[model samples]
Target: MAATETVAERPDYDPVALAESLASAADKSAKVLGDFIARQAAAGKSMVTDEFGLTQAFLELAAKMLSNPYRLAETQMNLWWEYSALWQSSMLKLMGQSTTPVVEPAKSDKRFRHEDWEEHFLFDYVKQSYLIAARWLHNTVANVEGLDEHTRRKVDFFTRQYIDALAPSNFALTNPEVFRETIASGGQNLVKGLNNLLDDIERGNGQLKISMTDSKAFELGVNIATTPGHVVFQNDLMQLIQYEPATAKVAKRPLLIMPPWINKYYILDLREKNSLIKWCVAQGLTVFVISWVNPDERHAAKDFVDYMLEGPLAALDAIEKVTGEKDANVLGYCLGGTLLAAALGHLAAKKDKRIVSASFMTSLIDFTGAGELEVFIDEEQVSSLERKMSERGYLEGSHMANTFNMLRSNDLIWSFVINNYLMGRDPFPFDLLHWNQDSTRMPAKMHS
Candidate 1:
């Protein structure tokens, strides 16, 4: 009886219990939201005006925000303190501790300093001015009457737009493909306009080449030399291997190629017709490719430093050894390009002067302007991810793949979903798609 009583006295607060409660709440919320959306669809109503739609959108955004454990924890901690302080005083009074003074710590000493009074006063004045202006606008809108139907509609539209703009739901997860398509479409239009203007300018001087060159033209016209008898050198880097020509007779100078570790080097060497590598070779450029080793559990201990030293530097050494050239032009694509920039910076700091010209393709440096990835790279999100990766020793390749897929959900993920799942059509084979499918694993250190 004593043992049973002791067992029964165990604390009720448990992590599993909290998790279950959260899941149940989430399930209920999802069900409610689904039903609301279904009702709106049945009614053939747009999401713009209906109160339920607005409310649902806000809830959805909130849910998305909460999905990030780090943000969720921070928010929860803040709310906890706010509510705790509110109730703490009452509880203390009820427990006969009211006579004891509750000393609240100062958040900032500057708030009390006399010198900062003017600054605080100015801030208060600006805040109050904004509040007064907002109230005036609200009152004016509420009192408006006898307006024409067109004017009323315009007002309604503006009001809805303002509310929607302020709604948190508007910031929820959006399809990346849609965003990319929009941007690309705009870019293409701009390019077309620019080209037309350029063509007009060139027409006055001579004949203008208005046509775009196909991949075949690049292969045949370029004079780098990829004939049958040409010898290409190969070197092994653990499980991976790199290939480059033994001698570049046509090339004026040696060129070093840095491919992203996320994908294989074969993208630049797909086939004779569409091979960028072959094109460069035909253009008289001495070329070398960096082949990244596919990582496994055993390679989890490797980090960014190891990749910097071994990957590009090793390729550089091989290029110099084969071509007898001390310096070479370096080109990097995407993540590889970013790594190359970092490596270059590191080398520059150390006063190393082996690199000549450097070129980057679709590579990100400053993340401040990163369009969609910001949703995933906030401090809270990264911290939560770090915790998970800490347990696994390394982040899995699938995780990185999923992130990229999410960035272009409409095109990379959902467009396929519609075609393959909804329409019941097989995926069409395209060279770009083929390359995308041939993704390589990122080493633990490089990934981190």
Candidate 2:
């Protein structure tokens, strides 16, 4: 106590560094504002569309809830009971007494994986409180009757999205890990996080395009898509890649792969250990893959019929020309599978047996169980999207990427929000995420 400590030994040291970081953050924030203003100005003359139609849907939801006051009362009563129990449990924990959580996160939920979420009393309380409220909200909306199926699904989907956005782990003040990082870094984490947020907004032209991976760490043909292949055929729709044979002798009929045009083909050939294209070639089969064009306004009029005619059908013709085989085995994935089914039907009608065998991977022939995606399929939303697409000639790849991210909002969207923005950490380089973030535009007719 008698000895005076130096400024270096003080816990609150380095005012200059902190001030510099804050100054840099302020500069970046100002730049962000300028960019946003420029974006709005550039879009001044563009027509605006209600892309989601969330307003009318929510109005109907509110109207239904008000019409059924007794149901609402019952739901509120149940929520109150849960909250009372949670309060009691939280008090017992505060007094160092054994207590059980009112609700636990799903086993697969990674947002609350930190030990502090369970070990720290306040964090535990926040987590359980949020879980209970979320459960009650989901159950109430899901049980809502009188609303049509599409409207009900839309309401339920968007409600979950709202709840996911409000999770404690997403906010630095509420997230224990982020909070600790903020304190340890003397709020520099926050300053850097601001810079990150501004960078993403600028990258998206004022929209928030979350960075999912270290994009610069990968390239198309260097580290990934490294399987030896050549563009044997190309047309307006796609480029057909023929991989070098791994064996002296190959299969009599080549294997033609039709990857989804909604994404690039490199997913199957991401790396050596996991490359499906390489694996197929090793099995003594000639592999042919369709790499769809990342279309632009020039391809606005290209339809599904054009895709079938020019995609798989054209590939089959080109394969015969190269390998001297009239028939070949075909495989399709996702949207490609849908196209394959249509092409098969078309060929069957023409009595064309060029396709000797067919395989489908995660294809959707029926829309009955379209799950959360059905939220975007209603007529109003579709029309709104079409209007937007008509002007641009194609739907932006990022728009579809964002839609898919919303399906797993906590995992794909909010988790990154916490790590990359709140915690001020760069996203780690990951192959699958790189692929996920490497989105391709969907042609207007094909997408619709």
Candidate 3:
């Protein structure tokens, strides 16, 4: 038999007192720290002049401190305290237990033992103050509107410094690895998953299987005399099919299909089911595709100017000559698009009006916000590439392919790595992969 014991009711917990005390302590700490920094700045003419080394030292110290488990734990604890204080005060006020709380203070841990934090704090305050000062200075100069050359140059220098300092990457030295790790981890997972799915699809669809009969039949067809209209134009840079109309009648205007040099042109004519070129021909548009010359060591000396003259422009001339159309509809894709834009600019400068209408697919004209490509396009990287191209007659097709592959490594390289090395399986046959493997070389001058 169990004796029934009466349980005493537990008292309700009130976080209001704790929240108020924390809020007061944080406010006092912030004021004291702010005052101390003010005094330090007042003593020194400028934060940058007085404590640049200290600032750098603090940054290094912060990196080392964050790497330590105990220091990280302390940071977390302090952050939690600040967050809890804010949360409790908000909740208490909502529950009518207390008034709204003051804003929580910035979480700084002295226990981490770094002189840099104080220096960093002072530096930031001074930098911000200088920015405000610079802005006023700029406005004053602008209002004067007749500053001397030297004075204008000084103003410009200050403006540049102020703007450059505001750049997000300037403070990136503080927590760079954190951002990098976050980006790399997410990108790796996404690419790995996508590649696995692609591999699975390739396996299920039996895309890799090449039947002997099919191979024999395709080879036989290639050898046999086909219709004169079925012309597969092959060169060092490009491969394209030129479809001529059976009848004497042809389209009034000929349209040239341009694809990104980064990838083969076959994406535009994947199959009979979804062939843009076939559809255009059927719709009374004379279609011609410019297969780029796959470059090799022999073509390394080529440059951008050479590509403009020989690649799209050559195709345009050939198309006009073949079809006898004075004006042609020019279509460009990606890099091809960029080349076309440049050609158009060159033509516009010369007032050349042979082109009727220009269409660009996923093409960029202005280099602003080019995103990830910017990392590889800086002076140092471009210079190195130029040097390599100069040494070699042409840029290797494999090198170009590798660069593109690195841009999306998880999908391009890692998937194959996992399938071939980890899973011990052969690469699944994909049209895109097939085209990717069929890379073309760039003339050295063109590539540079």
Which candidate has the highest lDDT of all? 2
Candidate 1, 1-448: lDDT as tens digits? 9999966765444456545644654565465556656766875656564311234334444454455667556555755554455356535555655422122213452122232222233332322233333333443443344444433433433443353233211221122222233253432322333333333224323222221112132331232223332324443332222334444456646777777877766677766687777677777676677767667666677777777777777767766776678888888888779879988998899998889889998888786677545445444556656654555456655566666765544356544433332222345645555555545565445555
Worst 10 residues of 2 by lDDT: 1-10
Off by over 4 Å in 1: 1-248
Ranking by lDDT: 2, 3, 1
| Predicted candidate 3 versus true structure: per-residue lDDT over 1-448, tens digit per residue | 1333312232333357545644654565465556656755665524344111223333443454455667456545755564566456545644656443333112441111233322333333333333344444444334333344434443444344454434222232232322243243433332333334344434324222111111222221233222224444444455555766644666788887788765667666644556666677667677777767656676666677777777777776666666677788889888879988998888889898778899998889888877545434544556667665666576656666765665655456544543442333345644445556656666766655
Best by TM-score: 2
Q: Residue 370 lDDT in model 1?
A: 71
Lowest summed lDDT across 10 adjacent residues in model 3 is found at 206-215
lDDT of each: 0.52, 0.90, 0.53
Question: Candidate 2's residue-wise lDDT over 121-208, tens digit each?
Answer: 9999999999999999999988877999888988899999999998899898889999888877778788778888888988887778
Candidate 2: misplaced stretches above 4 Å? 1-13, 45-49
Using all chains and alpha carbons, the TM-scores for the candidates as numbered come to 0.48, 0.94, 0.49
